[model samples]
Target chain A: MPFSISLTVNGVSRNVELDDPRVTLLDLLRERLDLPGTKKGCDRGQCGACTVLVDGRRVNSCLALALSHDGAEITTIEGVAQGDELHPVQAAFIAHDAFQCGFCTPGQIMSAIGLINEGQAGDDPERIREAMSGNLCRCAAYVGIVDAVIEAQKRLADAGRREAA
Target chain B: MKTFDYVRPATIAEAVAASAAPGAAYLASGTNLLDLMKVGAARPDRLIDITHIAGLDHIDWLADGGVRIGALVRNADLAHDPAFVRAYPAVAEALLSGASAQLRNAATGGGNLLQRTRCAYFGDPASACNKREPGSGCDALGGENRLHAVLGWSPSCIAVHPSDFCVPLVALDAVAEIEGRAGRREIPLESLYCLPGDAPQRETVLEPGDLIVALRLADPTAFARHARYLKLRERTSYAFAVVSAAAALAMEEGRIRQARLALGGVAAKPWRARAAEDILAGARPGETIFRRAAEAALADARPSGDNAYKIELARRIIVRALTLAAAGTPQRLPALPASPFSSAPGARHAA
Candidate 1:
């Protein structure tokens, strides 16, 4: 039987009615709610292309059932930018040319934001590489991706310090 | 994916009662189950979402200095927990080494423990996998047997259990607390997994409607402090193990006092290297002694033509893991060189 569940998508309240219970969060976001920022690479959980933040933690949206997350506060790549300005991680990706073809940019940006929130995006390139290992860039732009994450971490840290002072 | 009746029960009793219905299965995280469903491996008519069951998501410390990890504890949370990482670093390392961060954040403890094998035949419905459809001839017997079992396999099926957590849990002497129609019972983690005898369909000893409540670990012995988990995969991260070893050692007067060892990717279940541990008990800790122990562990290995490299690869991994364990170092040895065996995609080979 199909069920409708309320979810906090990005920042707005959403009550999506599912005609099929098997509709994954990836399909619900892209097809149902018209949120296409979260890209689906491999429908399976192997690829991290469908990564999104659920309750401040990054999870592959492809594997999650829509009903399983009844009231989860979901934040996709579309929600990252504030007004007209891009998030620091998004800006860093552009400044460093972290992506080519740009298909995986949304998931990569979301994963980087999650890595920083999870307190794992240190200034170390190797550590950033390991943390971001989930989000695969088929274009082999890992060098720039790692550099962008490191640079973004520094910028965020500096901005936090300034805010504190 | 098959559309099934989904019920989110708020309590364990309600969850258990709901799961007792015909063709019902519990869903937690759904990392493995949902994938299997998509592949036509699992066709449940009803799903009891146990993620909301109260008190089933905690990491509690027992009064006996052991740890009781609830079934719903996500892999990332357990891996990142300061206390869990400090107490059982090998367990945490094993969890972190298997899947990606996104998967780890969604996968739960019990689900990880009960995950099915990654054998190509098992996942493909067209393939003759006895695990998926009993009485179907084992297609992997003659085709793409590289990922098949090297130990404790029957002619009926040769698939190995692909759980990274079970390797270290077997070394740590963990027990799973199960709830079923009868009542709650504690079973040693070793006995919980049954070898693929003639009945390849019966993976675990879990009966219908049986649910794993939590896993209880014994107090970390001195050996646990100097432990290491070495997983040799095709790549460094986000890959299943071709051969993995979990080794723990307790040194006394510079001699081996106690040792615990377990091997994965070469067995029907997590094969505890009891013979290796016996060899290391009174022997000195060195290259030659560790090599002998590793040899003793693989004495009964029966490898197929495509996976014969696993025997030698696993032997070297055991010795290297033991060496690191003895030194109390967490640094993993570099992955072995590419194998001479056929590295063709297992799914491409037709029966």
Candidate 2:
């Protein structure tokens, strides 16, 4: 049965008609919404390349059924940057050379943002590395990824303190 | 993935009724179900989404110092719950050691309890697997049997339950609550999983249309306080355990009063080492006694050719876990190794 559902994607309302219920959130984001920034690496949840923020929690969109998350507030990589300014995590990824092929950069950035939001990514490099293990880098840029996450966490914290002050 | 009719029920009774329909399955987080569906292992004609059902998403503290975790409680929230962490650190540790952060955020309590094995042969439709297709011969019997079971396996199937949470739950003596058409009933968590006897297809004791309501832990005691979960995997993190142990001990004046031990990656289900527990009951907390207990635990272990190393590994991990539990030291995460992708010719180094 085809059902019409509405979702809040990247702070905007997205209403779509689903002919098939098995269409995954990753497919919907890429095909229906035309947001191809969230790459689908393995389609299974193991790769973490389809990671997106659903209700402020990081989840692999490839495993998520589109109909199951009808009203969820989803934030993909395409929404992370402003009109001109990139998110601190994205900026840090560039500064730290966190990618080789750039296919997994969006997912790595989203996962890093989730880590910072969960307050798990402290200044410690080991903690950051463990927390970011979900996002794999096939090009072995893990060193730069870890450094970027740690730096981004510090920068986010500093910004938070400034806003509070 | 095949196109299936999806229905989200707002009530438990409706969900149960929907589950009773022919070729119907209840979907929660879809961490495992979606993957299995994609691989054609599970082809349900109808999916009943139960994530919207209310009142099944809480972690309640019982009056008797026990904890009642709802069926819909996500693995990540359950692991990070302060009450669960403070009381049963081993449970939290076991959950953390199992899957990645993204998976833990989506996997629910009931889903984890009912998650299937990760046998490569079983996932492949063309391969001969009794679990995937009953009455078929087990291809893993002689083929690439490194990850096969070392204990509690029948000739039909040697696949082990790939869950880290079940190890600690069995050690803690937890109970599973189920709701069926008749009424609600409870059973020991260990009884929920069945041994892979002649009928390897029957994984759990859950009856048709029965929905797992919650998991309840009894009163927290000394065993809960002195507990440790040690998992050894192929890699430092984000990998399934090669062999793991969840050990808890209650001591009195340097003597063992009560002990609980469960082994993972060794059997069809979480293998509870009751014989080893008996050996450590009255013994002193020392290396010799721990070694004896570990030996007693593996006395009945029957390993395949390629996985014979698991016996020695399990023995060492059991002893190490018991020693750490006796000393009240929490297990530390192992350091990460350099990525295997780093050695590839096209891999780029960090600037």
Winner by DockQ? 2
RMSD of each: 5.1, 5.1
Tell how far residue A38 is off in model 2, in angstroms: 0.2
Task: Provide per-model DockQ scores.
Answer: 0.59, 0.68
Q: How close is every model to the real structure, measured as TM-score?
A: 0.95, 0.95
Candidate achieving the largest lDDT: 2
Write model 1 residue lDDT over B1-351, tens digit each, in one string.
777998999987788889878899999999998988988888889999998788888999998989999999999899888888778878887887878888889999999989989989899988998889999889999899887788898888889889888899998889999998888999999999988889999988898888999999978757656787877788767888899899888788888889999998998799899999999997778889988999999999987548888898899888777877776734331122111121222111111
Show the lowest summed lDDT stretch of 10 residues, model 2 chain B. Answer: B337-346
B220: Cα error in model 2, Å: 2.0
TM-score of chain B alone in model 2: 0.93
Compute the interface RMSD for each candidate structure.
3.0, 1.8
Error of 1 at B329 (Å): 3.6
Please, what are the lDDT tens digits per residue for candidate 2 over residues B1-351? 677889999999998888877888889999999999999988888999999999999999999989999999999899878778778888888887778889998899999999989988888888999998899889999988898799989899999999999898999899999988877899899999998898998999888888898999977778765787878788767888888899899888888899999999898899899999999998888889988999999998878648999998898888878877887734332223212221222222321
Query: What lDDT does each candidate get?
Result: 0.85, 0.86
